[model samples]
Target: MSKKIYSVICGTGKYIPTNIISNEVFLNNHFTDNSGKTFSQSNIEIIEKFEQITTINQRRFADDNLTTSDLGWLAAEDALNSSGIERESLDYIIFAQNFGELRHGNTGVDILPSLAARVKKKLNIVNPNTVAYDLLFGCPGWLQAMIQADYYIKSGEAHNVLVIGADILSRISDPHDRDSMIYADGAGATLLTSQTSNTPTGILTHKTRSDTLEYSEMLFMGDSYLPENGTKKGIYLKMHGRKLYQYALKHVPGAIQDCLNKSGVLLSDIKKVLIHQANGKMDDAILNRLYKLEGDLSVPFDVMPMTISWLGNSSVATIPTLLDLILKNELDGHKIKKGDKIIFASVGAGMNINAMIYQV
Candidate 1:
């Protein structure tokens, strides 16, 4: 029998815009409420409360000249350069994002010329056979794309694939809404290549599930009316924070446990848990519960590295960017060594939750 094929992450890259929006800036600006009236003292109090809840001090936003595809392209280029892989040799490109390109001051997304296709053109790759497509699995999108690429490599259908997760959520956010502080813009990319290996490597196992029937409405983006504006339509993201927090607390731990069991990896062997940078508090709670499932009441503080305080929640871009930072030794107290086991988990829109086991 031929040697077993496995997919291995060859390189990683990330792109964060230069524009910074701090909490102080939000405080200085006047914002209109849903009723078209300026926010009162009580509404202004929400900013401080938001900082306490999310621990997000600031976030990056793309420049007016850039689009979501542009961010993804810059990240993809860096990933390719790090991997030393020829662009023409890539067999596939899987790009993930919830909102496509957004016009300044516009809440609608541009759907034509898919982001994946745009990245392909930006890279100037001449291979017509290289397949490219966009994935929409919410925040778990990048991990989902990596899982799909693993199958393609294992099936001998592809040698290498580039996976990207990017979003310009600021473009779609309502500046008047306090929740907009949690959304940012950024992109991350990873290159996975197939290789023959006798021992297990790369993605060992994964689990993805969605609770659309019960929790889909818990978080969404849709039209919101401004009182005096007379039926204005803006697709702004909305979330029932408390309900979603409860949902995550109930389900995320179980999902991590299932992934570990499926991969035959012990909790003690995992060097790090790269979770989605959604809410710092929620993420800590989930990790606390997850460690408890392993029969340990004491939680390892450094086992998970967080970027939400600086990067905010860029949806799908969270995990890959965190991974890139850790891999490059940019994140303090977090580093991955060869043969170390890592677990990735995320929860986001679609009420979707997923976990994956990977070996470095």
Candidate 2:
């Protein structure tokens, strides 16, 4: 048979918690360092530089009482409802999270199954092979999960696939570290299936690449980084900012060009570029090369403000979160018409990069 096409038929929902943390609020709240002085006072120049360079304004954090799975459940329901893809129609659910219930027996082992059970119980679709385990690889998990689902749908092993990306940044961020401020808690979902009709714009081709050589560039660790004070503190994320930036600026565009070339699509053919909101600098560099923009591509400079300043860095959730925001707000009453080509590119902690080109 000819190759099958996997269409992202509909994206129904996004779930962000009630509580939001703004940059000003976080700075005041976390002002005091381990030393007596506030961070700005102690490291005046560094804080000032970070303020100018970073653009995230705010990010939502799950209540201390809630877990990553809770966020996932809400997002899952929203996605299923939004797509109108009945629970009975879903054959697989893949949950991706770099930070989830760690105190539990296993990290992501139970996360996927438990979330799957929630849908099964509600929709009453109880089948054995219908579910599979969870997977993790830092921020790239969303695209990685989508690529896997594409394979399953193409091979006819499944009909409907729900790939959810969820995370709790507060759990992974060191309260004392300034970098931690960039992270926020949230979830987004995409429904993937085999496209049998011309009306559906399915994923034409998929490719993912990772350079494990710099595996240690970003990571999380156990109590070694902190003392377990009976509080819920566990692992925290670590990153080499400059080094990672160098690698991403060099590699991500190349990966994107490769994907587009394989699909025989030219750069001019692309419409909206839904890039992973890694950072203003990195994203700017990549998008500039792709569109051949002289300076900034003028691609909604307003959107990255919160992404840069407040929300800190939401590894895998950034792309889908941006997608949700764009669909809800920016794409209205203006540009981004139908049949336009859009590209979703991502670069994350695992030193992983994904560049997917799609039509609107």
lDDT of 1: 0.87
* lDDT winner: 1
lDDT of 2: 0.65
Cα lDDT tens digits, model 2, 1-360, are 444455664764567778877665554344433232445353444455555665555677777676676676677787777777777677788877776553322333235345445544554566666684466867888888888887788787788988878887776666656666667777777777667654436676656888887555555453223333653444556566668788888888788888888777666666666666656767766776655532323444332222444455666666666576565564333344567776677788667888777766
Report the C-alpha lDDT of model 1 over 1-360, residue by residue, as the tens digit: 546888999989999889988877787545665555666665458678888999998899989988899999999998999899899999999998888776666555686788999999999989998899999988889988998998899999999999999998887776666667889889999999998988888888999899998999987875542423543464777777789999999999999999999999999889899999989999999998999899975776688999999889998899999999998899986889999999999998889999999998
Query: In candidate 2, how many Å is residue 247 off?
Result: 1.2
* Residue 79, candidate 2: alpha-carbon lDDT: 79
lDDT, candidates in the order shown = 0.87, 0.65
